[model samples]
Target: MDLQAAEKRTKELHNLLNKYNYEYHVLDNPSVPDAEYDALLKELVDLEETFPALKTSDSPSQRVGGEILDMFQKVQHHSPMLSLGNAFNEADLRDFDRKVRQAIGDSFSYVCELKIDGLAVSLRYVDGLFELGATRGDGTTGEDITANLRTIRSIPLRLNEQVSIEVRGEAFMPKKSFEALNKAKDENGEEPFANPRNAAAGSLRQLDPRIAASRNLDIFLYAIGDPGETGVRSHSQGLDLLDDLGFKTNKERQRCASIEDVLQYVEGWQEKRPHLPYEIDGIVIKVDSLEQQDELGTTAKSPRWAIAYKFPAEEVVTKLLNIELSVGRTGVLTPTALLEPVKVAGTTVKRASLHNEDLIREKDIKIGDSVVVKKAGDIIPEVVNVLVERRTGEEVDFLMPTHCPECESELVRIEGEVALRCINPKCPAQIREGLIHFVSRNAMNIDGLGERVVSQLFQEKLIEDVADLYKLTYEQLISLERMGEKSVANLLNAINASKSNSLERLLFGLGIRHVGSKAAKTIAMEFGNMDKLANATREDLTAINEIGDKMADSIVAFFEQEEAAELIQELKDSGVNMEYTGARPVAAEESDSVFAGKTIVLTGKLEQLSRNEAKEQIELLGGKITGSVSKKTDIVIAGEDAGSKLTKAEQLGIEIWDEEKLLEELKG
Candidate 1:
């Protein structure tokens, strides 16, 4: 067929397939048979293959899959993805209602939505075409997963109207899909995912879009990124707008006129949660009016206008068979309770974390005791308490092991820490855990190299350290059990790609004591590279604002170790990138701006800049932006509809600036 004919045919097929997909997935009504849809899709695919240039990003055929990505890029959210404060009971719900009423008066209603037990994501559309999709990483910044999100058929490639907007949603796996996936995994002798939420998150994080496409994942858009831009006056209207734009939204949502109505909805859903095809951990209640929401504003981490009412965790009684101990990568010993097989929250519970010796003693948990087991967040099975009254003198108190379970070294408790530590640098368990951390998603992020793979490599003596991973041969990997040619190739590709990661990832993966991901990023930016960081003294490190004395000491002590020095050299020889490639914060000494050396707190609805944008600019001018107002805060930037922070700043006698003043200062 000619190019013009192929293009025409592809366009027609796209329109047809999009309509059919919407009917089946969104509307829950299939207008055509699966076979007919498949035929049309196949035709479009063929046409696209013939006329490659005619293939567009929004074409229905693109929903199937795309090329594998090397790494997910970081995306800055235009608006912060603030989490909701939780309400666990009717009283908590009433408290939330009271708070809302106190802030915005009793005239406001609420919109209650089922909080899907899945990963939170942000989707951005440009001129009605889906442009970007991202994981909610740190609320402000997230990982770009546009390719993987495109595979979900329910997500519209192009909206009905040409509008640029950003929306928040939960990406999930249906119960049927999760069951089928677990069944297949079980049949293949592979470990199944703990729950549908985890399965969905894992599937969406796949570097290969094809993997995500095959998972049968779905999304329910809940909120708009900016309601004012959409001209939506309330939360319910925002959801309606999403639906009108051909986006999938949960039909279970309802507008509650009062707290009693909200309570009724919550109770009804809690009882019916088990019968649903998807998982919901809680109900999200939000003040319906956008103007009221603005008035209520937000805290540092959560929105004041919204609250999540979590369902009571399902609990079951089980016999405590025994307790097992294990050493983690940090040399900290942890205890696990071995329970008699019992079902809890739809999963069989045989084990639960005991946390530490102190917790075990505090709870007075004894072996062979009847205990209440409940899944925390409907994911992890945990022992709530022991039924000491039911004990028939058979239960024996569990003693904390004096020695390390793996290395047989004497365990010692640190000065300020609770967990018993082995303190053995060469401990096998610690080494194995370290290797796993090195390949973790937030670290080197080597795809196809999970904990199991890391364990296998450690057991085979093929890898001793993170550096050894770069030296792996195809022959050695291919000889390992379950390592097929394709799998080996993918692993090798992932390993090769990881060599290019920024210094912060390497710092976090190194497992430096007391240094978390955020601290690593801060230190990496401060020093710029591994060489400088290694040479940095405690004083040098402590000079940086975020690095505390403990962190500084830890970093200095780590770099002073001969083994640590050798490891850095080995990693450097393996061609790993050690430089901080990301944008660094402006130095206070280098800036003459008015915001220099000032600790600024921002609050309320900014008409000019989003919270993040304002914060970034403030920091760039050498100002430190904190979340809350305190005696230490030098300036509080109050925008239109300023809330509690503004009031608090005024009460504290802290200097406050409006948006115009902030803008003027920024200009100067």
Candidate 2:
């Protein structure tokens, strides 16, 4: 066909296919048969191949798959995809309702939605055309997965209306699709996925879009990034608007006029959950009114206007075959209960954490005993209790080991701690576990050095400590099991790249007794460099905010170790960066800006800057941005539709500034 003819035909084909897809996937009704639709799709594909220019992004042919991506690029979310606080029982739901009523009065209602057991994703559309899709990574930033998301047939390539909008959704793999995929994997002698949620997450994160397309994933767009822009007053109305825009939203959502109604809906769904095609872990309850939500305000982590009511975890009885003990990076030995393989909460439970020796004694847990196991929040398997009545006399009592399993060093129970710990700094298990932690995602974040590779390297005796990681050669790595030439090259590059990371990464990787990731970052920023931190006394560390006495003591003790000093020198010799490289917090006393030394709270939506951007800019100017308004607040930045926070500020007689004023001050 001619180019002009192909273009016209392509436009017609796009409309027909989109319509048919919506009818089949979204509406559960198909006007045309599979064969007829396939014929037309084939014709369009041939035309697109003939005239490549005719194959627009919005065309149905794009849904088949796209070119492979080397890596996923990070994209900053337009608005923070805040998580919801959870309600596990009826009382929790009631408490949530009471809190909402107390803030916004009793007249308000709620919109209850099924919390799909899947990954949370954000989709951005520009002028009705699908532009971007991203995973909810740390709320503020996400990985760009537009190619993978485009393959989900239920997600419209183009909205019915020509408007720019960003929506949030749950991307899920249906139960049948997950089963089929696992069946195929098992047939091919590959490890099968544990559950639908994991399968969906894995599928969406695939580097090749064709793999995601084959998984037959679906989505339910539940929320808009900014509802004010859409002029929706209520959450339910926004969902309706999403449906009108040709987005697939779960039809099972209910508008609850009271908490009683919400409870009834939750209870009803619990009984009928197993009958559904998709997996739902819980029900999400959100305050219906947008204005009311703004009035209610939010915490640092979650919105006060919404809460997720998680379903009760499924429980099953399984035989405890044995107890296994392993040492952690911190040298604490933990016991795990090996169980007879039994399905619990949709996954096979092979083992459960025994926690500590004290817990085992308290529960009187014995090997070969029938134990009741349940997944905590449907994610982590735990032994709920021992079914003592079913336990045979043949069941054996388990005992804790006095020596370290790997190093054979005598174990000691630290004062006030229940778990037995090996104090030996050179314990092989501790060293191995510490190496794994050092290369973990939140630590040095070396991509190619996973748990398996780390274990292999440790077993091969090619590495002894974290400092030795920098000394690894390509030859040493390539000789390891499953390590190819390309893999070794990548692994070496990743290891070398980790050296350039800011001091916080290294600090967290060091396995300090009480220092977590946040505390590590705080300490790193306060000290400026590793040398200063190493030299710092407990008094110096304790003076910093959030660094408690225990953490300070731990920090001082860690730096004082002879082995630590030697490791530091070795790392220095290997050309590893030891200085903090991120933005330094400006001391209030030293800053000249008006925002300096001020605790500021931002309320409502800003037209000029995103919440993160405003917070970052203010923080750079020595302003501490808090989530809630209080009497201590020096200033409140009130934007469009400023609610309870603004009211509180007014009542408290605190200074308030508009977005324009804040922008002007920031510029100065």
How far residue 487's Cα lies from its native spot in candidate 1, in Å, is: 53
Clashing pairs in 2: none
Q: Which tens-of-lDDT digit does each residue in 1-668 have in candidate 2?
A: 67777788888888899999887788654556555788788899899888887878888888978899999999999999999999999999999999888888889889999999999999999999999999999999999999999999999999999999999999999887886675444323244566798999999999999889888899999999999999989999999999999998986788899999999999978866775678999999999999999999899999999999999877999899999999877677888999999998677889897767877898899988999998753556888889889866999999898999989999987665566888898898989999999999989999988999999999999999988899999888877778999998898889889889999999999988767787898888888899999999888987676676767888888888898999999999998999999786576678899988888888877999988789988888888887556556889999987765787799899999999999999999
TM-score of each: 0.53, 0.52
Query: Candidate 2: minimum summed lDDT over ten consecutive residues — where?
Result: 183-192
Q: Report the C-alpha lDDT of model 1 over 483-520, residue by residue, as the tens digit.
A: 99999999999999999999999999998877777789
User: Model 2: residues >4 Å from true position, as ranges?
Assistant: 316-318, 321-668
Could you say which candidate leads in TM-score? 1
For every candidate structure, what is the RMSD over all alpha carbons to the true structure, in angstroms?
24.9, 26.2
lDDT of each: 0.87, 0.87
The TM-score of predicted model 1 comes to: 0.53
